[model samples]
Target: MTRIRISSGSRFEEEIGYSRAVIDGDHVWVSGTTGYDYAAMTIAEDVVAQARQTFENIAAALAQAGCSLDDVVRVLFIVPRREDWEPCWPVVKQYLGNARPASTLIHAGLQTDAMRIEIEVTARRPA
Candidate 1:
């Protein structure tokens, strides 16, 4: 198997030495993506908006690997506070509403002060 790195100008990736996503044949592993806009590099204040941005970022990575949310077999989400979980859930539901891949949520710390959530997804494309 060969590894292909996928990057989309996420500063952390450049500074931390990891690709936004990695493709190994039919398997695509998208790194955890925050809500920060890649272009503006800004994070939204509202939890719902932030969650949407995070999903969009993850979608972008999956698209690079020749797949979409439909191809995602799993999703992992992290939030800073327990109270934010409910607010974020609808956002995840909105984007991956029908796809309904196996998902998990964790309440913990984030990388930056402005960031409140992080998302990582694994997807498979037919060979």
Candidate 2:
């Protein structure tokens, strides 16, 4: 099996010596994605908006690997505060819809205050 690396223009991958996502056969593992919209290079201050953007970013990485949110098998969320999780959950549910993956939420001290969310997801394409 060959390892395929994906980079979604995030500096973390190259600077930190990591790929945005890595594909090993049928599975794609996305790195922890933040709410920073790289197009604008700015983070959203709103928790809900950040959650939506985080999923969008993850979906972009998956799409590049020929996968979609419906293919996701697991999801992880890191938020600065627990209250933020409440607002984020609804927005995330909207994006994932009926394809509920095994999910986990953690309260964290993020690298930036503007970044209210960090998300990671795993997706698998049928063999």
Candidate 3:
């Protein structure tokens, strides 16, 4: 099987030496993505807004990998503040409710304070 790499043009990816997502055979692994709008390099202050943007970022990466959020089989969410998690539930359900991927949430520090949330996902391309 051939491997393919997809980039979101985020400086962090180049600086950190990682692709936004990688495709191996029919599987796609998206990197931990934040809410920063790659084109504008800005993040919203609210956790809910950040959650929405984070999913958009993940969707873009998935699109590049020839898949969609519906193809996601697993998801991981990281929030620096435990309190911020529940506030993002509606946004999470809006995006992944249909896919209903196996999911996990972790409370931990992120690379930046402005980044209230980070999300990562694993998906399989449709057969």
RMSD of each: 1.2, 1.1, 0.6
Q: Write the residue-wise lDDT of candidate 1 on 10-88 in tens digits.
A: 7788898999999998889998888888999888988888889888888888888888988888889888878888877
Error of 1 at 73 (Å): 0.6
Candidate 2 per-residue lDDT over residues 81-115, each given as its tens digit? 88888867678878787679999988888888888
- Model 2, clash count? 0
Write down the lDDT of every candidate, Cα atoms only: 0.86, 0.87, 0.95
By TM-score, how accurate is candidate 2? Answer: 0.94
Ranking by lDDT: 3, 2, 1
1 or 2, greater by TM-score: 2
Clash counts per candidate, in order, are 0, 0, 0
Q: In candidate 3, what are the lDDT values of residues 1-127, reduced to their tens digit?
A: 8899999999999998999999999999999999999999999999999999999999999999888999999999999999999999999999999899999999999998999999999999998
Clashing pairs in 2: none
Whole-model lDDT for model 2 versus the true structure?
0.87
TM-score of each: 0.93, 0.94, 0.98
